[model samples]
Target: MGGSRHVATSSTHPGDLHIPGSHRFYCTAPCLSWRGGVGMRGSVPPPLIPVSPSSLLQPEPLLLAPSGTSRPAGSHRALRGSLERESFKPSSQPEEPKHNRRQPSPCPRSVVEAAKAHPTFGELFQFATPVLMWDQHFSPETWNRLKERHVPYGWQGLSHAAVSSTLRLLNASANRHLFDRRRFPGGCVRCAVVGNGGILNGSRQGEAIDAHDLVFRLNGAVIRGFEEDVGTKISFYGFTVNTMKNSLIAYEEYGFTQIPQAEDLKYIFIPSDVRDYIMLRSAIQGSPVPEGSDKGDEPRKYFGPEASAEKFKLLHPDFLHYLTARFLRSELLNMQYGHLYMPSTGALMLLTALHTCDQVSAYGFITANYEQFSDHYYEVEKKPLVFYANHDMLLEAELWRSLHQAGIMELYQRFQLENALHSAITPQPKRLAPGQDKWEESLAWRRNGLN
Candidate 1:
């Protein structure tokens, strides 16, 4: 912090600075009206300041929730950017191919269409009564010893340079078409996935946070309220259709409109259900559904026909196996989500990009003091991370912490040597909170088959 040449605006403020021996430059935009050092205490944080007046206070952005509107494009710019980077021009001087491998043929429309129509849930999971093929493919011994499995993949005692190089190759091929030219000329593409954990609430990382070629966000990503802290730009928004819809429904009062939209933003679908798969395909093809149907009447407007099968990239199943074997083991995976199997949706998406990008950074993810903050950094109202039937958030927090400590990624944190203006204010329970009685009701509903 002290090594940079400070660009001072006023006697009390600094404008910009160049760090010695570093490519990174820091800037400080100061306004006379700006009240610096607002603490994260009793008062609720405001939604992100609107980047453009046109984007302010519109109806919650509707997404194609099957029964509802589809989320607009530019939701997953970061992922698209990374994908574009992946599809970039192959290096001018091709290095020795990794092992001996032929270029894979372009996936056929029939295969792509079949996958589009496939039952997403069944494709990803199955009940263990007889144990599905995908579930049984892994040996229990391999499950019992994650570290041992890490050895066979290139991950055993992998160096940063080695990991970086492998990811670069993936990016160059996957995103070669998206970028007219590479950012670094010859440099590897970089991506940063920013979570919306409350740890970013008070952290002043706006400018520094946006330096990556791409940025990713997930559920409850309240940008307006946390703009000063998390920055105003969003490159990608990843979520299962249900999760995205749920967050918008759950956090509507806090200004959780559909994740921000940009002209170049690409919505990356994490297929979780049959409806999501159908809707995403419809969105890409620009097919108009009957207006009087239960779905919506209007032609879906969130995405244009520009999104075609060729441009979409699905996560490779092997990549998910690789992540589970290396970083997320029994202790963390089981603790976070029950059943020591499969990657969490967000984890799967992030790790997919990590395996494909040259460099990766994580933001708003679980930080050390997570329990002391709300579930999301952009929470309109402070709400603790509740354990729902859906997923194990706490265990995920632990995994994120472990990954951060291992230096495999970065987490946003604020430094305040003295008394901070505000502290994290805990949320008080509301009467008959939605989550409080849902589990028991859910059990009854399931027994009656009403769900």
Candidate 2:
């Protein structure tokens, strides 16, 4: 069952960011890495005034029906969760949003600027490109051609209002990039992108991972008992609503009862579908998912009451569109079932880090010898990695291999199982991550009605 909103009609919670049923608001983030249906499609449209507060589906009216009704087996829901675009709740102060951009401890100048473009597209992986979509990106021509076409990536089968309302709020407080450059010491930042692959099960790479200025983690990120292996600091989390919920339901026993929440953490919403927009909006608004695949979902449950506009970011569809086309292109797309493919969530997060951070280190991602380890580092029992059709793990592995060899990023890979197991038994220095105090454990795990 989906979590229901809880609050008192009286809005007198002195320090609380909001009272769910009350007219208050806040913002937050999370993501998952398991092989499941991950929708990845979007564009680099600019932000504009939302079409109309009354119709998130304006300019293009579509049918609306509750998914819970006696609808046909496969009839698509007109009122998608994200597409049910509603204007953001007016904040009492209505002040300009100040995002919680992570400023890691000052370090030497370190920014990623590849000297030459990879031969793949004759373009250096656009490291510092804009990532979030806004009003201007939603041009009429692009919508006319791609709204329902389902081509390169997301933004298909959605109405103008739905997309517009969502983008409008994104520009409300979020920045187009992952972090603020000025926050770093020398305009250089180091980051670690952590995946759940079993390579880190006992690798004891925690000290190395927590050493970076910022860290990105995703998909079944079970951190409690394995802090010695995965570290306790999480600067960013990337995931679609589908994966977040599915991970919660599927991995609850693994101890991932809640997504990591802290003052410094930010969420990167991959607009894989309109549903992502809906969840992102609700998360920003601190209310229930107004409509769509996740109707009645309480963003407050997963994010906590302090959900702020500055805490969230929506991945520009253009980024994904460019990524799949240039870097992670796979032959799977050529097969009859190829259209279902896009980069995995881990790939998206890793690449995002590669583009945004000066130095990138990947931990627990799939390596060439994936069969030697269990599916995920946090798994209770050994299970082979599942190759779902939606992603081509081999292609991603090769891309990482090439990039690692090219001196672009560090991929935590080793050919021998004995060496990996040695990491756990070996003695290593214990150290605290810089600014770890900002990411103290959240108390939301005790709350209820989490969808």
Candidate 3:
């Protein structure tokens, strides 16, 4: 009767017992097995039961619900506990072994030796007793000197904080391959400074221009359809922020929809205003131009998406001051438009190349016979070149001629053609009233955006 009663109870609660030759039933609560063991239903053959206090304190076995059935409230807590245990468990897999990474290739030994052997003007200046450094980095003393001596016209008043921030940001940018020895392995870097002057219109000097180790081009350098005359190679492009923006605005019709973006090409930023520093910082950071007259301006729109810190070079204000004090100072310094006067982009590039390269050849630059040709080589019509108070063309022309005579640089000269053309087109000087030489008219025209 007792055995029959146990069988009846097991039959009533099938989950408490494992029925032979049938699928097992799982239990939500602890159940007594047929052999007096305590465990979840359908685990395995019945085992011996534990009666110690330690056994009672042990955690309960996790309960899993059958398919299509709901789990009990305690089952949820068990699931969470199981997951926590799994998360805290140590991983058995080993970590990857780290290896030493290779460094970038250094500059060629020969070029380094050559740089040491032939001290450049910049190096000599730096070594002088009263030293004057000429690199892009500026000290506070140098910045103060530049502020006093050099005035960038379009900028707001100069401030130490602003200038310091610009320098700090620039210094934080990736280092450039400045005159890389690997690129100039022969230790004699020849450079071509190509200006946009119309002298290059029929010069047929493309092959000669491309042969140089580096080529510096500035302003409206339209070379797509006119590659035969201007050459396809451009190593460095130099421009002020004002000039670059103006060039894009003014010369979009002449195939200059974008600036040069060759993989190996670099940009030299002429710091003509605080906007330049702002733009440069934004460009390096790959962000929109922050707080300034050029707020919300996208630098990638001008310098392309791949533009990087290493690809942009800023000219130090002190360097500009040194260049002005040494080579390209104009008499306009004393005039009312003195603040507006600076060397043209071409003059700056040519002088920079002269100081950096072993040999430099200038092309399409203003000559004494500039009146014979159009204002720009890409001009479809032979428009007469207009003179402005901002640049001293006459002074630049004399300097070029003198530099050529001294053999410091090879300035492309077509004297016979220039002389003949000048003689044929020379006009009688229009007599102006005393102390009136069309300066005011030019200034007014420039102010009205006619330049």
Candidate 4:
């Protein structure tokens, strides 16, 4: 970081930050309600979401049986994003997006002080007892105990063999921290978690995104023709097996025909369904999927044939539970539809970065003005963002907004030029809560010092 460079603040809101002289930086912000299409849990399914197989979610409704009864056919899988379209023809390359933005040198960030300054971070951090589950943590006792809980926390309906085998194979790799601290040695390691929000459509943030030490991308991350906006580098790709396949099927027409593959790129599996464990096992063994919805599916088609266990990571169910319980505890959890709730894939990845990286920037994620743009920036046609019953995206938005205000993370938000300029010229300062004043005062100090 250059001494001359100073932290910038958004005139419209205290949470959003603008890097002085930098190409607008931050990654991911799209909370699509694909969860509405997920099979309802702990009860009967809801009315269909009017989605087709071609949609991002295939819509398989699950019906859980009584404690003593045999599980329903669909009960085996925790999630229902399995059905995919047969006409999955890849779309012609989308028109190449254009860019004229220049990137400034990197600005440093630290989550330590920022998280401490936050009102709820201490409480939330307590729940992160174990963020990633590796072989060393797996045991018959652990499995039996976890099995008592529901999905994303326990393996209730999943196979003991499948779970054990997967954990065993993760003996050495994919079970530890995301990256080596030795890589940065003694510096603030910055990360960018890119999303599929429409805000990044023309943001021209590609260069700035690649500037981070690590970049995380999730579901339907269409990058081919949009490199000018989302960047080409992917140090990590986060998704469930369902999402990876679903994105390929549902987004092929948008030019996302394949998942990103590289020798160094690691895959983070959320373990949302049995398909993820099965697929991960197969991928690590260099074999075809043996059973389940993706039976016979060749791992080579996705991960390169040489891909090893070192290239995959399985997020701990404990972490997922902690995130839901502590951070984005949506109201839907109390409803009949609550069982279907899970944080969007993007939310999971961004949170993962926050815990692992010194600093995180969320790009293309949902903002207050989400209605102003389509669901996805790369959609050939403009499709309004759908609010499905499966995910309470609005709640996630509040968390992101608060995290921004707390200075725990930087979420790049775009306001209309006229409005931004207007706010800049005639600011209407809101009554902030206690401790929030520190954020504003800190920004002011930096801005004044830079001047």
Clashes found in each candidate (C-alpha, N, C closer than 3 A): 34, 29, 0, 10
Output the worst ten-in-a-row residue range by lDDT, candidate 4: 51-60
lDDT for model 1, on a 0 to 1 scale? 0.39
Query: Which candidate achieves the best TM-score against the true structure?
Result: 4
- Cα lDDT listed for each candidate: 0.39, 0.59, 0.55, 0.64
TM for every model, in the order presented, reads 0.49, 0.67, 0.62, 0.71
Worst 10 residues of 2 by lDDT: 438-447
Q: Which candidate gets the maximum lDDT versus the true structure?
A: 4
Give stretches of model 3 more than 4 Å off. 1-150, 153-156, 172-177, 415-451
lDDT of 3 by residue, 370-438 (tens): 766777888888766645434566557756655554455788865445455566577722222233222
- State the lDDT at 270 in candidate 1: 48
- lDDT tens per residue, model 1, 1-451: 2332422211111111223333222221101111243211111111111110000001111111121222233322222222211111111110112342212213232122222243321122111111001212234442333222221121223333322322232332323232223454644455677776666778877777687767777666677767778887666666654455445555666787655566656455543333333444455456753221115521244444354433333332233343443333222121211121233456755664443444556776654445556666665566664332123343455444434443445555543333233444544322122222221222222223211
lDDT of 2 by residue, 1-451 (tens): 1355432211111111222432222111112222233212221111111110011111111222221223233211221222322222211111112442333424343323331333321233443345566655567765664464342255566767777777667665345667876677565688999999988898899999999989999867889999999999899998877667666766777887898899899988877667787888788788899897578889988888998778887776656665664455443343333345567889999988876787889999887677678878887788766454346665577566666655668899856646458768864322222332100101011011011
For 306-397, candidate 4 gives per-residue lDDT tens digits of 98888888898777766665555543443344455577788999888887777899998877667656778797666666554445555566
Model 3 C-alpha lDDT versus the unseen true structure: 0.55
Report model 3's TM-score to 2 decimal places: 0.62
